[model samples]
Target: MKKYQPFLLTILLLALFPALAKSEVPIQKGERLNLSRCVETALRNHPVVQGARDTIRIGESRIGQAQANYYPQVNWQTDYTRINRSRTGNSTYSDYNSSVVLSQTLYDFGKTKTSVNIEKLTTDSFRQDLHRAETEIVYGVKSAYFSLLQAEKNRDVAVETVAQFQHHLTQAKGFFEVGTKPKFDVTKAEVDLSNAVLNRIRAENDLRIARVGLVNALGIPSAPEFSLDDSPLFQKEKIDLADALERAYRNRPDLQSIGKKVEAADESIKLARKGYYPYVTGSAGYGYSGEDFPLRDGWNVGALLNVPLFSGFQTRYAVEEAKASLDVLRANEASLRQTIRLEVEQALSNLREAQERTEATRVAVRQAEENAELANGRYDAGVGNPIEVTDALVSLSNARTAYIAALTDCRIAQAGLEKSIGKRD
Candidate 1:
């Protein structure tokens, strides 16, 4: 029974506080997280994405509030009052009143309809904002995922370099003991080995930092340590600049959101102008009023007309303010369109550059690897100097590093381009 007690307690806690369970680490140690999984986790858990979704809900609620004016409003009121007639007869009386009233808008010169339409448009805008948040989260996850991969590759390169230097050191010591290579060869190899070890340490630390970055991008800072599935970083995506620009213009969520805002602003201007017209409201009430029991009962119905009449130029200023706001939104929409074009062009340019670098570095790494092998072989044959061996190894390391960087850049550039074009998935 005691053995089951702890398990029962755990279940009880989880049932009582579901949020506590949600706060636990989302990923398990040694779990392999892929790019898609990371993006999904981010979209599901990121505070920004959650907040954006909440904003959409708020906008939806506002739409309901605006439409409420089209429906009848009911209210019930009860009050008791003690009146003193001292000025007339020094007499006091108690009065009680109770009433239930229903009021509905009869006409508002399209004001209610326009207001509801504006709210609907604004809600659509918020939906687009949510899409934008999702796109941004996806891009952040992709960029961080690629960065972690790059760091992992760089760390591997460092480890390999360290191993090669260790081998060289062993070869140098063997040659010196056999009276073939100078003590200088042994000393140089030792120094190079030490430097490679230092680089490996730095690389390991960088890999750790990259992992932290990836976890942050996942929006799960307390997630357990996990491995990532290696994605193809060198794959080139074929995209036309014209097509990308067109897609960005057509699909960018920020642009779409702003466009919706512009439409809403147009309606806002109309709503503001409606202040110059009269609005009609019809009301009906049933009530009982008396100072004692068995109170008299009565019912009444009436229609009220509200006119702006004279408002000290308040309506004029409201109309001007609305028009100015609309103008501002239009300007912003134009600026956002231009910004989208620039982003698409920049992403495309970066992707092209990274592709070119990847191809060039691929060749460089191959050549450097061959050169390192030849240099090591020649040294083993007592034909190559320690300087040549060291330079060849360094060149190989640099080439590998460059290749890793190019691949990472390619992946990040693709992510940026997708985000620029508002690729939600």
Candidate 2:
């Protein structure tokens, strides 16, 4: 039993090891988060970012492999054999052989050097890919952050509308009790209150959905119930289209990655062309051999010139393939540049439209608020009907919602513009 206890403990510890290693700090209930924190969290925790980092490591390893030819290779080998001499009365004998060899490349007409350069370029491309991943995550976080803020604002407006309707219903009931309003007014007010409650319910559900979106964007879906601090500010900034385009071309990681690939492809062509040249290698070996007792020892040194007379056009085809790949990469680079231009233009246009709408809706909300107040006052003074009050309140609610939407759009548009211009911050 005691022996089994140790085995069981070992098994238990092994089982728990994986869980402990993979455990992440849980988000506390009601934790407050802002946009910058969300972006940082996503960058640190997202699988896409981690995968990109792994890709860079792989490229770095490949660079080492390409550089390995610069160093000597050492190897040791051993062999034993038993021989039967049937003609000599079936006599048997054993033979043993061992050797240590050191080989190094003397020259390859810049083949190894070009390969190393290509690998370095490839690693640079992987680094750019990592940057691109982080940029995308940042943009996603920003978009989700703004969306959640919008949902919160809309929900607030819904709650306010419900409160206004409840007040109106109470006023209608009071007027009816005094015989100043008809029963129809009381019934209408009840119906409007019910609709407002329903809208509030829907708004609350939408807010929950927005919370889920933000959690997903943060790459922390297991996060507990948390609160976001609203911080949407609309500020106008001047942007030049030409300058934006230039920045995108200079800073976009995907474009830079492709450019590195193009350079690697050119180096590939050079490496393939070197296949037609001769390679010089030097090797030295020490060996021991014996049939019995002490063995005889010997050492040898030699140089080899391996010239490629022909290879069924393999070298020719490799060069051709490298050129074709280069052409494809160039075409892709051109296409990406065009797409970047369109993205920047569209982002700018959307931002302008959203800003204009925000201004318009801001004014509309103020007017609606004033109109609603006047209508409610008129009803209290017994000069306005229930319909006027309802209409004014509905208009006010809609104006507030529109203003929220416009503000959210402006924020999202600004994020889009930043992404298009390759601004990671």
Candidate 3:
């Protein structure tokens, strides 16, 4: 993976404006955020998770509409008429009608039942989608958090380097005043100190940019200034590929969602086939009709059966469509499994590589620190040159940077593995 450029640029702007390094948007003491808090905030506020939840409610409404077919439908109606006739002695008369009618589907060969089942399955699928969205946001927060930590560490390294160079410049000036060191040594020390100041400015810029990225990941792009606590950078985690693969297969919400869709498609196919059978409907009504109010009353009930003969093969086409949808879902399920397997493998590879890099950089940091100390000691003893000290400091800085990068990579890789296995928390 490419290094997190946004986080790394946190302090670059500070290089251009050195005064801002000291008072640059100080982080509030009470604004410190941790990984779990960030994840929770994102889940509560992110639009993706909110949309997924809304889909669940939509699915529930569809289920209610499907079930309405099983209940009796009632309607109340009224009509009035007045007529004046010229052909039979010109008589005026009035007629009134009022009625309440109820209709219900007695049987449809389980068509309504199948539709309800499909809706329920679809709702369950969307519930799984919600889970997937939460998981993705958690991983994103973890990545940003780790990158912020890395950038902070790098800033500290830059500060220490500047201090070291300042100390060297002071010593050279002292020696030059006493006529022990040449003018070249003092000039070299001055040059090194200037470079260290430049680096420190860049590191400060990186810290600011990193904070912005963390805020974005938390789903609060306009959040106030904040900081993070120190976290262990080299904690090794042991994982078995076989076990991870099994967990991914069982727990991945996206895969389970696709399976639910396939089941719903099967139900759709059954619903379409119901068109081949006859449907029974029954209706009942009560009414009063007369020239005046309360004149007469009547009641009636009836049942009807309708069978399909042919209608341009619409039923056949519906069944075919359902079958095709099922086939597509199955294909998607297969593709998802392959994708899950690849994710697990890639995460494992990244974790192992990061672990190795962390170890290598850890050793390098120790050696470089020792070398810098030795070089500085030699220069103090009046035998070493400025070049030796400058080279040693550069090596030490590079080692620290590499170690920080490696540690951040390790944390991100672990998060990736957890995501692949659908591990919450």
In TM-score terms, which candidate is top?
Answer: 1
Candidate 1 lDDT, 27-104, residue by residue in tens: 768888888888888998899999999998999899899989989999998999999998988989999999999999
> How many clashes would you count in candidate 2?
0
Backbone clash pairs for candidate 2 read none
lDDT of 2: 0.91
Best by lDDT: 1
Candidate 1, run of 10 with poorest lDDT: 19-28
Higher-ranked by TM-score: 1 or 3: 1
Steric collisions counted per model: 0, 0, 10
Give a tens-digit lDDT track for model 3, residues 75-176. 997899997888979998999989999999999999999999999999999999998988898888888888889999999999999999999999899889
Cα displacement (Å) at residue 221, model 3: 2.5
Estimate the Cα RMSD of every predicted model relative to the unseen true structure.
3.6, 6.0, 11.2
Q: In candidate 3, which residue ranges exceed 4 Å CA deviation?
A: 1-31, 79-96, 290-296
Compared with the true structure, what per-residue lDDT tens digits does model 2 show for residues 140-227?
9888988888888899999999999999999999999999999988999999999999999999999999989888888889888877
Off by over 4 Å in 2: 1-28, 83-92
Backbone clashes counted, model 1: 0
